[model samples]
Target: MDLSEIKGRIREKSNIVDVMAEYIRLQKVGKRYRAICPFHQDTKPSLYIDPEKEMFHCFGCGAGGDVFNFIMLIERLDFMGAMKLLAERAGITIGDIEHKKGD
Candidate 1:
């Protein structure tokens, strides 16, 4: 899938807290959520998840982005691969969109 389409899908299906929860034990912190960074070793919960922005940033390691970005970083894949993986998780058929886009 293309960048915008992937971004749109991520925006639709992902909640920042829920996505972050997959990798870390998140606790409510003020308006946002906090967790330890999974990408790097940490002890004091340096990961921050902004649900309203649909973004994550690590205060310790500087990794940041939306759900797809998290997937790309953790899975070590490029954008399209992350999109396909997330699309499958959401049960959205990428092939259908691909077919329509070609027309």
Candidate 2:
């Protein structure tokens, strides 16, 4: 599949809380999950994860995004690499997509 298709699959299969919990400990807070920001030296919980939105944001470091973006930042991966990683984690296979000359 193409990048957009892969991204959609990743988002549908990967839960924000589940993926984030794999990297850090998370505590339920109201309608979201809270944890210390891994992108910075956070002494207090500054990362908030919204499962409903499938997104995360750090109040301390200003880092935020969906599951793919989170993985890209945390794992230091490019877009394709992040997609492959999350696809593997979600047991979703991404078939090779032929890119156009300009793409």
For every candidate structure, what is the RMSD over all alpha carbons to the true structure, in angstroms?
A: 3.6, 2.0
Name the candidate that leads on lDDT: 2
Residue 59 of candidate 1: its Cα lDDT?
94
Off by over 4 Å in 2: 98-103
User: What would the per-residue lDDT of candidate 2 be over residues 2-82, giving only the tens digit for each residue?
Assistant: 666667778899998999899999999899999989999999999999999988999998999998889999999998899
Task: Supply the TM-score for candidate 1.
Answer: 0.82
lDDT of 1 by residue, 1-103 (tens): 5556755875598666776677678888889888888889898988888888888899999999988899899889997788787877777777634434533
Instruction: Report how far off residue 25 is in candidate 2 (Å).
Output: 0.5
- Model 1: pairs clashing at backbone N, Cα or C within 3 Å: none
Q: Residue pairs in steric clash, candidate 2? A: none
